[model samples]
Target: MTTYFHTAAALCLAAGMASAQSADVPDNLDKLSNFQSTGVTEFTFIEQDGRYAEGIKRTLERITLPDGFKIELYAVVPDARHMAVGPQGIVTFVGTRKDKVWAVTDRNKDRVADEVKDFAPSLTFSIPNGPCFSPDGFLYIAEQNRVLLFPAAEFFYESPDVAAFNLVAKGDLVPPEEESFNHTARVCKIGPDGKIYISLGQPFNVAPADKLDLYNEWGIGGMIRMNTDGTGREVYTYGIRNSVGHDFHPVTGELWFTDNQVDGMGDDIPPGELNRQTEMGQNFGHPWFGGGTVRTNEYKGEEVPVEVVHPVVDMVAHAADLGMSFYTGNMFPEKYKNAIFSAQHGSWNRTTPVGARVMVTYVDAEGNATSEPFAEGWIDENDEYLGRPVDVAQLRDGSILVSDDLAGALYRISYGE
Candidate 1:
C-alpha cells in the first residue's frame, strides 16, 4: 500500500503545482498526467442535511408524479446541470454551468447520496456541464472549450487527484473566435457506435451570412461525434439552433435530441423541438426554420438553402427543452417502457411562467410521437420557479435522477418496490 501511494503521488504532482500554474485560474492537468502533485488540498463540500438542504426537500414535496411514483431529495449538488451515473453504480458525477463537477456517492446504496463533493479539486473547469461514462467506466467531461477523460473515475474519485487527461484539448473542440459563454454549455454521450458525441450550440441567436460556411464546416450549430481518443471527428447532426439534450433509441439505435427554439419571436410563435435523426448529416432547420417549420425572422421569405427534417415533437415555444433520456429501466410500470423522459427548464420572459417540469413521450409503432407532463408543480401560483429541472439520468437499479440547477439539487424518482 505504501508503494502504491508513492507511485500514485509521483503520478499527478511532481512539484508544487500551484507555483507552476496561473494564480488566478489554476489548471494542472498536464502536470498531473506527467505524474506530479498540485499542492492544492482544499476541497468544497456540500452538506447533505441542513437547513439549505431541508428547503430543497420541502420543494420536492410539491412535485406531483404519477400515482405509485415517489420523488425524494437525492443529493445537494450546486448548479447541477447534468448527471452521469457510473457503470458500477458506486458514484454519480454531476456537472455545472460554473466550474465544478460534483462526485455524489450513496455508500450503502440507500438511494440517497450520502456524500457530495467536488471531483478533481486541482483542475479548473469552465462550464463543465456534460458528463458521460463509457461502458468500461471512463468518464468524459464536456467543457466549454475542451473534453476531459478520467479513466476509472468511480474508483479514483475519493482523492483530490486522479488519472486525468484531455481527449480534446482546450481551444480544439471549437475555434477560439467561436467561444462564447452564451450558448456553449456542452452535453456529451457515448454513442452506440462506441464514439463520443457532443453537442455544440452555436454562439448566436441566428446564424449570419458570414458564419454559415464556417459553422457548417465545424458543426457549430449541431452535434459532432469522434473516437474515444479524439480521432475521426465529424459532424453527425446538422443545423439546429441550440440542443442541450440527446440520447440514442434503445431498440432502433437512432439518435434523438431536444432543441431550444429561437427567442424574441413572441412566447407562442415558433415551438421548441424534440427531434429524431434517422441518418447522419440531416439538417434540422436552424436559421431557415426556427422550430417545427416556423421560419426564423432573419431568413424570412427566402428559399431554405438545405433540405430540412422537421422535429418529431413540436413543443411549446420558449419552454426551453434541455436534457433527455430514454426509460430503459424496468422499475417503473410497463407503460413507461421505452418512454422518453425530458426536462423543460421553464420560460424566461413569458407573461406568465410555464414549464419547470419533467415531460414523458411515447413513440408508437407507426412512428407517431405523443408527449405529456409526467412530473410537475415546480412553478408556483405566484409565477415563480421553485425548481427548474435540467437533466434526467437513470441509476443502475431502475430509478431515475433529475438535476435542478435553479434549486441546486438532485431528486430521485422511483416506482413501487
Candidate 2:
C-alpha cells in the first residue's frame, strides 16, 4: 500500500498536471477511467484554514452524546456514504454517491486515520454507494447498475489493480430503458443465510400504474437475495420506494431496513420508516401508504394487492433515513447492546431541516421496539446543517464510525471517554 506522505506529493503533482490538460478529456465512462487512472490519489482534502477548523471544533463541542461517550474527527473523506470495515481490521472501505470509494487506515492504532486514499483507483465507479464484505474477505460493491466482487479485497486493495469479477454485469441490475437517476442509490449486505442481499430503489416517486407490473417483475422496488456467485436470484421483499440501508438481526437473523417516504406531501404528515421483515416475500407499503398507514395522493383509491407491513418505528417526516447497522459490540454500555444505530441524512425539501443525527432503536426480547435520539446537534440553532450523517458502521474495537457527506468527513464515536 502507498504510504501517506508518498501519496500526498504524487497526488498534488498529478492534480496540477490534470489541470493543464483539461482540454483533451475523453467522453463518458472512458473519460472517468482516464481521470481516475491518473496518479491523483487524493481527490479531496479537509479544510485546514483557521476559520474552517475553528468552526468544526465549535460544532464538535456542541454535539451531545450519552454519558461517558465522546466523538472525534476520524478522517477527511469526500462524499463518504456507506462503509465496510475490513476483516483484518486494518482498513475501512467507504463508498460514495459519486464516482469514488475511499480506503482509510489507522496505522498506529490511535483510532485516528493516518491516511485516506482512493480505493481501486484504476477503475471507474458509477455511484458505488454500497460495499459489503463476507466473512472470508470477499468484498462486493453495489454500483448504480452492476455488482462487482473482489476476492481477498482486504489484502489486495493496496495495489493499483485489484482482481475483480462482475457478479451482476452492467445493464443487468435493472432494465436499461427503465433506469432513472432518481433514487438510484443501491445498498447491499450479507445475510445470515450467507446470501448477498441487495436493495433496488425504484426511480419514480410513486411508480406509475403502467410501470408497476414491470417494476415488480424486475425486482426494481424490492430487495433481492442471491448466492455469493450471483446465482439463485429471487426477490426477498417488495413494495419499497427507496431503501438505502438494511442489516440482518444478530440473533433472530431477520432483515431490518430504513425507507425514505414519498415527498411532495407536507413537511410533517407522512413519516419515514424503519421496517422489519421476518419472512421472504414480505411487502412494505410504498405507493398505497406513504410511510405508516397514511394513504398517498396518487394511489389513495387503488386496491392493495399484498399485505402492507408497518414499520418497527416511525421517524419524523422528511428525515431521509438512509443507512443503519445493529450494535453488537461490547464497547458501549449494556443498554446499547443489540440496539440499532441508524442515520437520518436530513431533509432537503422541508422548510426547517430535521434529522442530521444518529438514532438508536431498542428492541426487547418480545420484538417490541422503541427509538430515540442517540446523537444530536448536527442541525444548528439557525436550522443549517453543520454535518449530515449518512451511514453507521462499527469498527473492530467497538467504536462506531459515522460518515458525513455534507462535511466530507468521518467521525468516530466511542464510549467510556
Candidate 3:
C-alpha cells in the first residue's frame, strides 16, 4: 500500500504545476502501446496578457490519457457544447456562443469526422444548453424556455440539411408566480417512461422571498417533468439552483445532474453539486440549504430542515459544473465504467481560481458518485486556463470526444487493448 501511494504521489509530482512542466511528458507505461497523445504540450498556461482566459481559448494540440488511448484534434469548430451520439456514428452538438447546432459524421469509417455541417442555427434564443437524441430517433434541442424537436433524417450521413421535424415543446412551464426568473434552457431526453425532464434555474441566487413557494414545499426549487408532447407537467425536483447538464446513469437508470452553487456565499462555502435524482420531487438544498447546509449569503436567516436532501458529491467551489455524461464505452479500462464526466467552466468571482477542466465522479458498486480529478492541468499555477472542456461525447469506437467552446475545437481520446 505504501508503495502504491508513493507511486501515485510521484506521478502527481511529475505532472507538476501546469506551467512549470513540459506538455509532452513521456509515457512510462509500455504495456499499453495503442495510446498516443495529441495537440501541443509546451504552451504556457497563462496568456500573453497575464489574464486568465475563459473557455477553450487556445487550440488543443494534444491530450494525455491512459497508455492505451490516443488523443487527437478531432475537428475545428466554434463553441461546441452538449452533444448526443446517434446509432449511425453521428455527432450532434450545440454551440453556446456560435449559436448553432453542428453535426459531424464518420461516413468513411476512418475513425475521424469526415463531414461536418450545421444542422440548425439560433432561431429564437441566445444560448443553446443541450442537443439530445430521443429514443424515437428525433433530435431534441433546448433553447432557453423552449424545446425544439427535429427528425433524424436532417442529419443522417447523406440526408438533407434541414430536418423534417417541427418545434414540439416551448416554455409553457409556468412557475407559480412570474417575477422575472433567471432561467436556463436545459431539457434532458425523455426517460424510458416517456417523461421529459427539464431543469429550471432559480429565480435568484437564493429563494428571494421570505416565504418559500408551494407551502414552503420542501426540496422544491426548479425542476419539472412533463409528457413528451408537453402535457402532464409536474415538478420533479426542488431546490435545484441551476442544472446546466444532466443524464441518466447507463446501468442503474438513475438520474444525475450538475448544479452550480449560489455565488457571494464566500470563496469556499458553497461548493457545486453532483446530485442523484433518487426520488421524484426530491430536494437537494439550494437557497435555504446548500453547500452541506452552509446558508446562502443572500438569505442568512432561513433555516434548513433535517429532511433536506444532501448532495451525493460536492465539487470545488465556483468550479461551475456544466455538462455531464456517463462512460459506458470499452475504450479505456474497467475503472472508467459508469464514471461521470463533468465540465467545470472555471470561475471568475473567486479570488483563488477554480474550475476550468473536466472532473470524473467515480462510481462505486452501488452507483454513488465520488469526486475525483479525471482531467486537470487546464489551469496553470500562474492562474491561466488554456481550455475549458464544455461537454463530453462517446464516439463510435468507444473513444471520448470533448468540446472546448473557448478554443472552438474538438478533442478525441481513443484507447486500445
Candidate 4:
C-alpha cells in the first residue's frame, strides 16, 4: 500500500526511534564549528516547523534495490553538496551553504560515519562545491572558482575544531591568463593515472557572450586534466556545458561524465549528455550543438563555423543527472557488476520535473549507455520536492551511501541474499 506522510510526521517518528538508540546529536549548534568534540554523530532527518527550517523534506521512504538488500540512515549533514570518500574510509563532504568541508569518521567500524568533524572552512571562497581525492592521496577541494589541495594528514585528522586541520597547497590552478570565466570551476576527480581532472561550468547559457567571452574563446566546456601536483594542465575534452558527476569506467577505463544542458531552451530539444572521454582535447559541443545536430542561434557569429561534440547517450532533457558511480563491489548481483547508478536531482526551472529519482545507466560491454529509473517517489504529484540526491559512495561492506542535501540526511543501501 502506498503511504503518505508529511515531512514533520515522518521526522517525528524517525527522531523518536533514533533518540533511544543514541543521543549523540550535536548540541543544537548553528554549524559544525567544533571538529574534535563533535566528531561522533548520528544523522536524523527531522522537518522544521518554523522559518529557520530551510524548506527541505526527506521524501525517500526506502532505498529500493534488488531482493537481498536493506537500507538505513547513516548521518545527516547540512547543505551537503558534493562529497568524496577517500581511500582511508573517510567520509568527506562539502557544505555549500554552511561554508565548510566536513570529515565524518566510522570510528565504530559499523560501516557508517559515527563522528563528524570539519576539514576545511570557507577560508577562501563564498562556496565550496566539489571535493575529491587525488590519485596521490591528497584531498582536493574546489572553493568556488579556485581549487585547493590538502594533505592526507589534514584530511584524516579527527579533531573537533576547524583550526586543527592543515593546508598543503591552495591556489588557482586555472589562472585568468590561461582561461577566464566565473563558471565556478571544480576539481571533480583524479584518475588512476595520477592526473587530476576538473569540471568547468558555462558562464552564460550560450557561448561568446560579450560580458565574459574568454570561456567561449578558450573552448572551456568539458573536463581538464593535470598532474597531481597541478602540472601539465590540458583540456581533457570540450563541449560539456556543466558536467557534475564523473568517474572512470571500471571496465573500459574511460572517464564517463554527466553533462547538464542549457535552460530556457525547448523542453526536449537540447537533451543532456552522458559522454565517455576517449582522448584529450576532444570536443563535446555545447551552445552550438544539442543531442547531436539541433544547433542553436547562439553560434550565428561563428568565426570558423563552429562544430561541437556528440554525446554517447542522451538520457533525457532536464533530468539533472548528478552524482554517479559504477558498482564494482560484489555486494550486488553479477548482472549489476560495473553498472552505473546516478541520481537525477530533479529540475526546478522545467515545467515538468524530470529528475529527483535515482536511475541506473545500463552500459553494454562496448561501453554504450541505456538508462532506466531505479529509485523513484522523490517528488509528490503536487509539484513539491521531497529529497534531492547529490552524491553516492560505497562503504567497506559493499553497500552504497546516497547523500540527500535537501533534507540533510545520508542513506545507505545494502544487499544480502
Candidate 5:
C-alpha cells in the first residue's frame, strides 16, 4: 500500500478549498496552496499557447540525428537546468536557474510523463540549478548558496510539504561578500567515494589578483567536496572559470566536466573545454590560460603561479558546453558504450552563433578522446536559437532526457525506437 503523507495538503488544493489572497503570487510558501492542479498531464505535448508547439514541431523537422535514433517531447518544465533520476526510476527531479525544482513522473510506464509539478512548493528556492541522488535514495539539491537534502524525495514529491533538511545553511556555502548574480549555477554529484562534489563558479570573467588567493582557498573558482553530512569541506579541483556539469567515469572514476570559456574574445578563439581530473588538487587554468593556452587579457604577460592541467578536448569557441553524462546503459549501440554525451547551451557572445546541440565524446580505453556532433539543428539557418540544451541525463531504461530552458520543455531521446 502506498502512503500519502501530505494528503491533507493535497486534498485542500484538489478540492478547490484554498485560494491566494494576493494578486501576485510571491516567492514563498503561501503560493503552494494555489497549485491545486499539477498544471499539465504527462506525455501530453505543451504548445505554450500554440506558438511554442509550432516551433517545436518545426525544430524537430529540421533536427538531424544518427540512424534509428528519435527524439520526442517529455514534459513542460520552466527554466529546467540539471536533473537526477530517482533510485526506483519512478521519478525525475529537475532543478532550474529560477526558484523551483520540478518533479516529473510517468505513472503508467508509457515512457512519457504523467504529472509535472513543483517538488516543494512551500519552500522558496534560490537558483536551485543542480539535483543529484545518492545510491540510497537521498536527493540533494545544490542551490546558489545552500544545499538541501530530501530523504526519499522520489516517493514524497507528490505532496506540497515534503521532508527536507539543510546540509549547507544559507550564506554558508561561500563568503557573503563573494556572492554574485553571475555564474552562480551550483552543480552537485555524488562521487564514487560517497562524498558530495559541487562546482562553485567564479563570479567574474577573469578574477582579479586580489581575490585569486582567497578563491583558491575557499574553492570558489573550482570544485569542492564534502561528506554527505556536510562536514570536512575541502577543495577537490581548482582553476576553473564556470562548470555547469560534470560526471564520474564509470570505469576509471576520474572526474570529467565542462567549463565555459571567457567571453569577449574573438568568435573563433579560446575554445570551450571538456576536462578530466585524475587526482586531487588538480588545476584547470582559468584567468591564467583562459580556455586552452589562450592567455587572458588581464594576465597576458604575467607568469602563471601554478601548474595548469589542460582539457581533454578543446571544443568550438563559445560553444557554452554545460551538462554531461557517461553512457553506461545497454540500450544503445556498442559504439555508444562508455561514451560521454554533453550539452552545448549555445553562445550569445558570438556574432555567428554556434552550438545549441548535443555533443558526444568517445573515450578510448587508453584515455584518448574524440568528439563529434550527435544531435543538432537547434539553431536555425538564421542563427536564431530554437532550443538551448542545458543538461543531459540518462534514464533508467537507457533513453536520454535533455532539458531546454529556452523552450521551457524536456525532451526524451531514444534509440532503436
Candidate 6:
C-alpha cells in the first residue's frame, strides 16, 4: 500500500494483497476489496443495443438545440446524477442518488458508450452522488457520510474489485445524525489550486438560527476544500441552502456554483442562484435571502449579521439548476468560448414545468453574466417530464455530456454532428 491509501482514520483488519482493508471498511467489503469474490459476480449491466436505448434515442429527436448542435444518446445510466470525465479519457465515472456508481467506457472512440456497469461493486456506498477526478487521474467519490478515493480509476475500473481507500472515513463527511436523503447529493471538483472542493447541503428548508453556528462549524450549508489526502479541511464558502453543482473557473480560478433556494415560497418568489466566490469565507445569503436579493420568510425581520454576496446570475424561480461546467471545448463557435453550460433539472411542484433542459451562461469582461436556454424539449405537451437533467460534463474530445436521472441516460451534445 502506498502513502496515498495511508490515513490515520482508516485502521484496517483484513484485506486482499492490494485491497484497502480498514476499520472503516465492513466485513463484507473485506471480501470485495480483496478481489476474493464473495459469490457476488453477477453485475447489473445496462443494455447498450436494445429497444430501451432506441427509445432514449427517439426522445433525443424531440430535443431542440441551437443551430449546428445536436444531442444523441451516449449511454443508458440509471439515476445518473453527477459525472466526472477521467483525465485519461479512458472511462467516465458517473454517480447516482442511490447506492451505485457506474463506469461507462467507449473503447471504439465512437463517442457512444460500449459498456456500462457498476463501479467497485465490492465496496458499499450510500448516496455516492459526486465523482470528480484529480488532474493526475485519481477518482474521489463524495458519499453521504464518507469520501472514498480510487487511484487510476480510469485504468483500474475494468476489474470488479479495484484498489480503494478512504479519503474521509465513514460518518466523517458529515455527522451521521445530520444525514438526510433529500438535498444530500454532493458535487465535487478539483480546483485550480490542486485541492478537492466538495459541497455540503444543509438538510432543511431553512436552517434554524440555533443550528447556524453548528452548520457553520461543520460546513453543512457551505462548500469545503481539502488536500487530496484529506487534510487541511476548511469551510471555503458559506450561506447556501443546497448547492448540487459547482466548478472552478479555468481562467480566474474562482469557484462558481448553483444553489437551490427555499421551497414553499410560491412558484416565483426567490429565483435560483448561480454564485461566484472570489475569495474564501464569502457568505451567500441562505436563511436570510432565499435566493437572489429576496429574503426568506423565516428571517424576514432579523438583521443579517454576515456580509452576503448576492448571486452573479439569478435564474428562473423553481427551475432547479443543478450541475454546470465552463465550455473550453473547440467543437463550438467562438461565441461559446468560456461560456458556462448548465442543466435545469426542472421543478418538482411548479404550476407549469419550467426547466428540464440545458442552459448557457456567458460572463462578460466586466464580470456580468447572463443565461439562456441551450437545449430544450425534455418536457412534453402534457407537462410531464421525459428526462430530468442533472450534471454537465465536457469530454476530452471537445463535445459535452449531459446526465439525466429521470431518463437514466447520458446524452452527448456536439456541434455539426
3 versus 4: better lDDT goes to: 4
Number of the top-ranking candidate, with lDDT as the measure: 1
Q: Model 2, 43-94: lDDT tens per residue?
A: 3333323344345556778889988999988877766899999989988989
Task: Please report, as a residue range, the 10-residue window in candidate 5 with the lowest summed lDDT.
Answer: 40-49
State in Å the error of residue 111, model 6.
1.0
lDDT of each: 0.88, 0.84, 0.62, 0.62, 0.84, 0.87
Which 10 consecutive residues of model 1 have the lowest summed lDDT? 1-10
Better of 4 and 6 by lDDT: 6
Q: Write the per-residue lDDT of candidate 6 for residues 57-122, one digit (tens) a residue.
A: 899999999999989999988779999999989999999887779899999999999888888865
Q: Residue by residue across 161-275, what tens digits does model 4's lDDT show?
A: 2332222133344445544344553547778777877787765576654533455343356677777666677767777777778888886678888887777777775777777
> Worst lDDT window (10 residues) for model 3?
43-52
Model 5, 282-326: lDDT tens digits are: 999888978987999989999888899999999999999999999
Model 1 per-residue lDDT tens digits across residues 1-417: 011111224313422352354357568898778758888676666667767778888888888999999999998877789999999999999998877798999998889998888899889887899999999999999999999999889998888878799999999999998899789889999989999999999988887878988988888899999999999999998998899999998888889999998888887978999999999999999988878988888999899888899999999888899999999998999988889999999999888888899999998755568999999999988889999999999998999999998888899999995
* CA error at residue 277 for candidate 2, angstroms: 0.2
Of 4 and 5, the candidate ahead on lDDT is 5
* Full candidate order by lDDT, most accurate first: 1, 6, 5, 2, 4, 3
Q: In terms of TM-score, which candidate is stronger, 2 or 3?
A: 2
Per-prediction TM-score, please? 0.94, 0.90, 0.77, 0.78, 0.89, 0.92
Q: Top TM-score: which candidate number?
A: 1
Spell out the clash pairs found in candidate 2: none
